[model samples]
Target: MIALAGAIGTGLFLGSGKAIQRAGPVGTLIGYSTIGGLVICVMLCLAELSALAPVSGAYVRHAEYFVDPALSFAIGWIAVYGPCVSVPSEWVAVSTIVRYWTDLHPGIIIAICIVVSFLTNIFFIRVFGEVELISAMLKIALIIGLILFGLVYDLGGVPGQSRLGFWYWVEPGAFGEGYLVGGGIGRFCGFFSVLVNAVYSFAGVETTSIAAAETKNPRRNIPRAAKHIFVRVFVFYILSLFVVGLIVPSNDPHLLTSTGNAAQSPFVIAAEKAGVRVLPSIINAVVVTSAWSSGNHGILQGSRSLYALALEDKAPAFFRRTSRWGIPYLCVIFQSSFMFLAYMSLNSDANTVFGWLSNLTASSTLAVWVVVGTCSLRVRWAMEAQGIPYQELPYSAPLQPYLAHVVTWFSSFIMLSGGFYVFVDGHWNVSDFFSSYFTIPLSLALYLGWKLLKGTSIVPLEEVPVGTFIAIARANPEPPLRKKKGVVGWFGRFWWD
Candidate 1:
C-alpha cells in the first residue's frame, strides 16, 4: 500500500490533465500503459535481487557486492536525492490542491502541508507504517469505487444517462482531428510530449523493493507484494485512464494547454464533463487526499534512503541519528526543510524550479533503475562463478540473466533518449536543458570525486566485509519468539522454580 500511494500521485491525477491535451486520449493511454509495462519489467528484476539480499539498502547493497563499489555509491547518492527533489514537487502539488478550496496563499498552504508530513514521519516506524497502510487503503477504495461507478454509469444503469462507449471516441476521433490543426511532425510532437509526462506517473514503483527491508518476512512476503503491486498499479492506472478518456473527449474546451494553469486535473475535468452533479467536487476532494498521502509517504521513503546511505558511511554521519522510536529524525527534518522551500515557489516563479527539479529527479530515477537491472545480472554471474547452487535458491527470476539484460537496455534507451523529445520540441531553454541533463554529469562527478578523495578502489566481492554488511542488514531485527512455558501442574517443583 505504501508503494501504491507513493507512486500514484498528483502526477497522474493533475499532471495528466495537460498530457491529455497534448496527446489526446488514445496516445496518452497507450503511452502510459507502455511505460507501465517497462516499469514492471524493472520491478521484476529488482524483485529477484531483493529476494537474494532482503536488506535495508536493497539495490544499493546489491550494487556494492555484485557490481562495482562506484556503481553502488552513485546509485545510493541518487536515491538520497530522489526524495529531496520529489518531496518539494509533491508539496507544490498539495498547495495546488488547497487552491481548489479557497483563495488562500499557496505559500502558507505549502508550509502547513510540509509541517504535517514532517510530523507524521517523526513518530515510531510502526506508527508511521500503520498510518500509511490506512491512507493507501483509502486511495485504493476510492479508485475501485470510481471505476465501478463509471462502469455502471456507462451501462445505462444510471437514470437519464445513455451509454457513451464510442460516443466521445467517435466525436473526437482517436487523435484530436482539428484540435491542433496543420498536419506535420509538429502535430505529432504534441502527442510525443506525453512520454516524459508518463515517466512521472510511474515514478516510485521501486518503493516495493525499498520496503522489502522492513517487511516481517521478506523471502515469503516480498515476492507476493511485488506481484500484487504490479497487478494493482497496472489495473488502477489503465482502467482509470480508460474511463476518464471515455467520459471526457480529448478535445474538451477546458482541457489545459501548455500555457494554461497547472492547477487543473484531468479527473476533475472528466467528472465535470460526465455531468454527474457534485461528482467533480467530490473528485477534487479525493485528489487532495491523494496528494497529501503521496507527499507523506514520499517523505517517509526518502528519509529511509538517506538512513541507509548513512549506515553504509556513504552519506553524512548525522543522517544516521535516530530517535528512541527508531525513526530517522535527522533525515526527516532535513527532507522536510527542503519541502518547505517549495512554498516559496508558491509566491514566486517557482514553476520553473519545480519543472527543473522534477525533470532531473525523474531522469535520476531512471538511471537508478538501469543500474539495478545491471546489478542483478552481475549478481547472477557472481553466484554462478562461485559455484553457488542455483537450484536451491529460495526464489529465482524467470528467464534468469536474459530478462534482466533486456530490461537494462530498455531502461537505458528511455533514459538516454528521454531528453530528445524536449530538445526536438525547442523547449530546450537554458534552464530546461540544464535541469534535464545535469543529473547525468552530476552523478558521475559526485561518484568520481568521492572515489578520488577517499583513494578507494572498487571493492571486489571477496574483499568486501560480508560480516559488516550482514550486521547492517540485521540492525532492525525482528522480535524473537518466546520459549514455551511449562505447565504449573505439579506445583513449584514441576515449574522448575
Candidate 2:
C-alpha cells in the first residue's frame, strides 16, 4: 500500500503537464515506456539484493556492503533529503489543489496538512500504515475513475459536445515541438525530459524493501510486492498519461496555469472543455488526499533513512532516540522540519515551489537508481567470488549482472542529462539549472566529504562479505506459506509469495 500510494502522487497529477508540455502525447508515452522498463530492471535488481539481505535502510545498506561506506553515506543522506523535500512538495501540492475551491493562503493549507501528517506519524507506525493503506485505496480508485472520466470526456459523452476522439492528438499533433530547436530536436528533447520527470513519480516503489526488516517472510513478500508494484504502477502511469493526453492537448495554456489547482490538471482541463462544470472540484479533492498520502510517505522514508544512518553512527545520535512506542520520534521530528520549506510557497505560488522541489529531487532519485544498480552488480560479483550458486539464493532476479549494468548506465545517462534544458538556447535560467542538476554535485560533495573524514574505501569483490549474509539467510529462510493445493495455491503464490 505504501509503495502504491507513494508513487502515485503529484508527479502523475500535476508535474505530468510539464512532461506533456515538454514532450508531445506520443513522445510522452514513449519516454514513460522507456523509463518504465528501466524501473522494472531496477526493481528486479533490488529484489535480489533485498531478498538476500532485507534490512531497514535496504539499498543504502546494500551500497555500504557492496560499494563504499562513503558512497553509501552520500546516497543515504540524499535519500533522507529527497523525502524531506518531497513532504513539503506534497504539502505545496495540497495547497495547490485546495486553492481550487477556496481563496485561503497556500501556507495555511500547507500547515494544516503537514501538521496532520506529522501528528499521525509521530505516535503510531501501525496507525500511520493504516492511513496510508486507505490513502492507497483511494488513490487507486480515483485514478481509475479519472481515467474512465477522461475517456467519456474525450469521446464527447457530455451533453452539447461534439465527438472529440483523438482530435487533440491531430490538432496539436503528437509532439509539443519543444523550444530547443522548436522542431524535431525540441520534440526529442521534450521526450528525453519526460524520461527524467517520470523517475520522481516512480520514487517510492521500493517501499516494500524498506519495510523488509519488519516483514516476517521477506524473501517471499518482497518479490511479490516488487513484481506487483511494477505491473500496477506501469499500467496506472501509462493509462493515466494516455488518457490525459488524449483528452487535453499538450499545448493547452491551462496546462501551465499558475492557479496551483487541479484546474491545471489535463484531466480537469479536458472535462471543462467538454463542458463538465463540477469534476475539477471532485478531482482536486481526491488529489488532495494523494498529496496527503505523498507527504506521509515522505516522512516515513526520511525518518527511517535518518534513523538508519544514526544507527550506523553516520548521523547525529539524537536521531536514533525513540519514543515509548518505539517510534523514532526525534528522527520523525527532524524529517518533518523540511516540510516547512513549503512555506517558500507563501512568497511564491505553490506551483513554483513544487517545480523547484521536483527538479531538486528528480535527479537524486535517478542517482539512487544508479547506485542501487551498481550495488546489485557488486552483490552478484561477490556471490560468484564466494562460489554461491545463484540457485541457492532464496529468490533470484532474472537477468543477472548484465541487466544491472544496463540499468546503471541508462540511469546514469538520464541523471547526467537531467538539466539538458538549461543548455537549450533562449531557455536559460540559473535556478532551474541549479535545481535540476544540483543533486549530482551535492552527492559528490557528500561522498568526498565523508571520504575525507572517514577514509573508507570500496569493498573489493573477493573481500566482500557475501558469506555472512548468505549464512544468515540460510539459517533464517523465508517462512513457508501453506494452503490448499488447488485454487488457493495460485493466490498463495502471489499473497504468500
Candidate topping TM-score: 2
Residues forming the 10-long window of minimal summed lDDT in candidate 1: 488-497
lDDT of 2 by residue, 139-186 (tens): 899889988988887777867877778887787878875746777877
lDDT for each residue of candidate 1 in 1-497, tens digit (9 for 90 to 100)? 77877777777777777667766677778878878877777777887777667877788877777776777788887887777777788777766666666778777877788777777788645676676677677777778877887777666667777887757767665555432334545446556556667777778888787766677867656766777777778788889877777776777776744322333576776555457768766776767777777777777777888888888888899999988888889988877777765755645554455566667667877878888888777766655655555554445767778778877887777666766655554445776677667778877887788778776576554544333433444563434433354555444332221
Report the alpha-carbon TM-score of model 2 versus the true structure: 0.94
TM for every model, in the order presented, reads 0.85, 0.94
RMSD of candidate 1 to true structure, Å:
8.2
Q: Model-by-model lDDT, in order?
A: 0.71, 0.83
Error of 1 at 194 (Å): 2.5
After superposition on all C-alphas, the RMSD of every candidate to the true structure, in Å, is: 8.2, 2.3
